[model samples]
Target: MNRFVRWLSASALALLATIVLLPQPAAAAPIPCGHDCLGISRDAICWEKEWCAVPIEIKGTLPKEGYALPYRTADGTASAPADYTEVREGVLWLKPGGSLQLEVFVEGDSVRERGETFLIEYLDREGRVVATATVVIRDGV
Candidate 1:
């Protein structure tokens, strides 16, 4: 009787341990944009004298939170405030399932020169690149 009781108690403990050690499945979070969640109307733009506007649209499930879209001009013959007016580095209050616009200015000049090209990028909070748009400034001589 004593041996049977001990065996029963050990079996119960082993069963309890097995149950406690079992791994639980984690709750999965939904992906806001599965693959292509962000989009831009024009990847490249041509501007002369007048400012150019590029439209950006977000497509997919709207996130519950709003994001501040970060952007910067880089690696282009055009210089900020020289070739054109300084573009706003970042935009604010960009909510999910919404759209925004980026404006590029071209400073008027008389000298004939090759068109200048520049890139405008959108970055996440972690500074990761989300999207990019190229602007071509054709000299209006």
Candidate 2:
């Protein structure tokens, strides 16, 4: 009886360990832009410019909880694990001409920063797309 109890306990521990080591969903590597993609999505988001920083207000629903989002710039670079503020009353709501002012301060003394948000629009019903736009910021230009 004692031996059976120990074996059951050990089995439970092993199963728990295996579950903890399991992998989470991984976003597939971005595919190259086929024609001309002006927006960011599951594939990739690209931009271009010189010396800039801008705060974007992401309006709309996100993927499941804890979805790893990627932020890619125009110069073959990306920055993310972005500042994702929670949704509350007046939190993340944007009027037609309303805006949120985020900052992007690049390092280096004389390095020019040219960054742009190629596509900044919310996906619509049926998860297709409705309106799309780009936000460009040229910091210290």
Best model number under TM-score: 1
The local distance difference test score of each candidate is 0.65, 0.35
**lDDT leader:** 1
Q: In candidate 1, where is summed lDDT lowest over 10 consecutive residues?
A: 27-36
**Per-residue lDDT of candidate 2, residues 71-97 (tens digit):** 322222323212111111111222334
RMSD in Å for all candidates: 18.1, 15.5
Local error of candidate 2 at residue 131 (angstroms): 0.9
Residue-by-residue lDDT tens digits, candidate 1, 47-76: 578977766665554446765556766657
RMSD of 2: 15.5
TM-scores for the candidates? 0.58, 0.25
The per-candidate count of clashes, in order, stands at 0, 11
User: What TM-score does model 2 achieve against the real structure?
Assistant: 0.25
